[model samples]
Target: MSIDITWGRGDGAASVSTVAELDATLDTISRAHTEHLPYCVTLIAPGRGEFPVMLDICIGHPERSFVYHVAADGSSAWGYQPDLEPGPPFTFDYAGSPTDAWPERTRVTDATARQAARQFLTSGGQRPPALTWETVE
Candidate 1:
């Protein structure tokens, strides 16, 4: 299954079918300022219509980032947050704009984020089992 990965404002879109390609692409996209806007990337298994299942990652920093998943029909959306305890809110560049995730939406390490991305890609956009996902409010 091939997944289309689009970073920033869509200029870095590419399709990857294997884990290695995904890994390499992820590695390239994970770097800040790699693209015109080094904020986030959206992964989609195309041909599912306009609202396809999407896995998005905010890779503003190498060590910490955020993940979000959305169902095709738009019935559900989730954010990965391993820790639920309240903490300082995180602000990062998202699609070229500064966006903030709530304190409850804790940041995750790159390893954790990558694991979730891999799971999402392998499962064809299914909610990743590698991380704890809470419904987006």
Candidate 2:
């Protein structure tokens, strides 16, 4: 299955089928952030039925991300706290929205962030087993 990736204020999203392709696209997103454009990478994976699972990743110092199961009943979950300090929200620009934010409690190191992304991609959007998660909203 292919995953759709989007970043910055662009409406266009790239469809990638392999981990290598996802990594390359993530590299581009990281470079964009390095240039001071705070954009989050959003990944959409095909789920069971109508709605697809979504993973939004804000890759920066204390990278942050969350996964939404997107069930038919509209329930969702988040990437739970992984022993990180519950610091203030890290604000960023995401798809034309300047107020997009993620809490530091959901933060992880760069390596951990990459691993989470890989897990999501490889598992076809399943909540990553390598990371702690909690059902919310």
User: How do the residues 2-29 of candidate 2 rate in per-residue lDDT, one tens digit apiece?
Assistant: 8888776674579999989988887877
Give the range of the ten consecutive residues with the poorest summed lDDT in model 2: 64-73
RMSD of each: 2.9, 2.6
lDDT of 1 by residue, 1-137 (tens): 88988875544788998889998888877654644433667888755656788888766454466678887776555555556344356566565566776655555666777788898889887878877766756
Candidate 2 backbone collisions, by pair: none
Q: Could you tally the backbone clashes for each prediction?
A: 0, 0
TM-score list, all predictions: 0.79, 0.79
RMSD of 2: 2.6
Estimate every model's Cα lDDT from 0 to 1.
Answer: 0.70, 0.66
Candidate 1 ranges with C-alpha deviation above 4 Å: 32-38, 81-90
